[model samples]
Target: MKIPFLGGRQALLDPTLVAPMSTAARPELTGGRRIGVLVQHGFTGNPASMRPWAQDLAERGYAVEMPLLPGHGTRWQDLNKVTWDDWVATVEGALDKLVAENDAVVAVGLSMGGALCLRLAADHGDDLAGIVVVNAAVDTLRKDVKLLPVLKHAVPAMPGIANDIKKPGADEHGYPMTPLRAAASMFAGYAELRRDLPRITIPVLFFRSAEDHVVDISSSRAINAGLSSKDFEERVLEDSYHVATLDHDAPRIFAESAEFIERVTREQQG
Candidate 1:
């Protein structure tokens, strides 16, 4: 089932063909120390999935930066050329810059973006004020996922996993295909983050969809089981799917995240 907007036309394959919603930056409010919020999108997805959430933060006077991950927001074939390290480096650099500019920084992410946020929290625990993750994917139960190492070489692409929202007419503007080699690299990153979850001591607000088709609830269970964060909180999204940020509960996620950022910033900076 191909959507009309994302037709399988050749024009959809070029990274430079159109401007991506990622890499957006909002200036800090005047005369006040603003909290910085860095929002990230999921694997095979672009900043389109994260824009509304980031925009809400910007409107609330927080400095916002949403970066397009390396090889993402482009053709799926492009993802084959990059490794997971490249993705992590892009996000890490953004987080570092946000930390340098603001009094506090909160990391917000969805799906694999959540995994990257966990990685940031683990490595840069002292620098982060808090974290918000929606439908974070830490592990997978697919039996075929085990064949990725070999399948990556054999299969270049697979069906896409974009627009997993319950809302109608919502588009995430993601790649139409899924790159196999890049997925293998993502899994490697997930495994490493799972091992380092104990290092993430910052406050976390985790959201999981009750009926997600892309990532299972077990992924959230694994993250909660491994996290050492004393301030960890989990909420089940009853009205959404994998892309809760763009679904029926988007407003709830945005409003709650803003509140979480405010509460954590006050507690930490006061």
Candidate 2:
């Protein structure tokens, strides 16, 4: 008997097409400042979704690190065995390394990657200059999520939420199926994240796709209501979806993020 979405066969992905390799760049000092940036991809997503953005930053002479999260950049079935803590630990380790090596560090993330960045800011704000989150999720209104605890035990996977981009031919190369246990762990941690939002006192640059299909507006609203940062800013992506980092507004995201990083890092120096 074959389960609907239980195994690696459900992915049907061409591994080469995914561009799953991790990205790292250690450039010469920019304006005599040793600045670093940590770029992160979302849940079930590899470095493919964030490579372009990470590359753009690296070109600007900043140290950049985009690590492949455990259980990602591989078969979807492997994700089922990992928990949310595994994802957070990966990004946190990257941030720690950057902080120790640079005068200032900025963390940038997409989707669930954004949530991990926020967690870092909350716990390590003093070590970070700022953070940028694109289509980040902190809270959800999806009633079905309440059943995740039970559903995950019965079903191995569900329909995927990847590639929610408005641009034609844009692919995040994420999993074709959502592993139930992994997803359940992600949503389960949101409450704790929300509670710690007040701890994120550093500057935050938030990007929300106007037509996002994966993460809803409730997340932005929650961030707006919960953050204690006076430097919080939200920009709307008019022509993109959940994967705005890879959508038509990608250039805008890169340009603005570069400016944000420069300004925040400079400000930290003073």
Candidate 3:
């Protein structure tokens, strides 16, 4: 579909690149422990960004569910038609499925994916072992955001915020334009998310890029200040940008997250 604001050109969405992924747990690899993980991608992006991370966890004997959220993995214009609740419902369903089949479950998300994970943690803390969020955005400092209520009616989309990586060739395969109506919906829900932050009592591993063009430090500060989890740990990704999952520091994120998942799930089982 041709995005409205962008010139009349159809977005080239590769099916393989944006496909949802699922991997069953191999208990023998983890000494017969069944652990499941819900991995999620960001707004305007699809499972491609989290595929490697999900695969890494799956290789470590964890059941992984990397779902393509509603209004994503398709055209940017599709995103404009979906609400924040649609995105949340998709992740919640994925998490629910993982919880039913595993002894323990952890959620991992990037950017808006991170926000969705936090929401899951708030509502389903007892169902989750822990959560890992990379460059999760809960709030924005942009003055343009204030105009969204009026601007969304006038404009269909703005510039895209995908693929903010320091590594040269890495791509998240996200939409080229940011859907204004969807962006406003995501931003509007942040107030309630912030209010519910104190309900997330499970362990949280937060990763923040030292330099991110798309999301500033305000979000990290809000998260750090609002979370009620005593087990929260924040790590700085010095070498990457907002899309840290596919950037130079991606290996670090994958390794540390795996370790965190292992430890948290083991503790939950105990």
Q: Estimate each model's TM-score.
A: 0.92, 0.93, 0.96
Residue 212, candidate 2: alpha-carbon lDDT? 86
Better of 1 and 2 by lDDT: 2
Over the stretch 133-199, how does candidate 1's per-residue lDDT look in tens digits? Answer: 9999989988898899999988998988988889998877777788999999999889888899998
Per lDDT, the best of the predicted structures is 3
Pairs in clash, predicted candidate 3: none
Q: Which stretches of candidate 1 lie over 4 Å from their true place?
A: 1-10, 13-31
User: Alpha-carbon error at 231 in model 3, in Å?
Assistant: 0.2
Clashing pairs for predicted structure model 2, backbone only: none
- At residue 228, candidate 2 shows an lDDT of 97
lDDT by residue (tens digit), candidate 2, 1-270 = 112344437544455544533334444547878889999899978788898898898888888888888888768888998988999998888888887787889999998999999999999999899999999999898999999999999999988888888889888888878999998999987888999998889999999999989899889998999999999999999999899988999999999999999999999999
| Winning candidate number (TM-score) | 3
User: Better model by TM-score, 1 or 2?
Assistant: 2
Instruction: Give the alpha carbon lDDT tens digit for every residue of 190-243 in model 3.
Output: 878988998999999999999999888889989999999999999999999999
Q: Which regions of candidate 3 fall more than 4 Å away from where they truly are?
A: 1-7
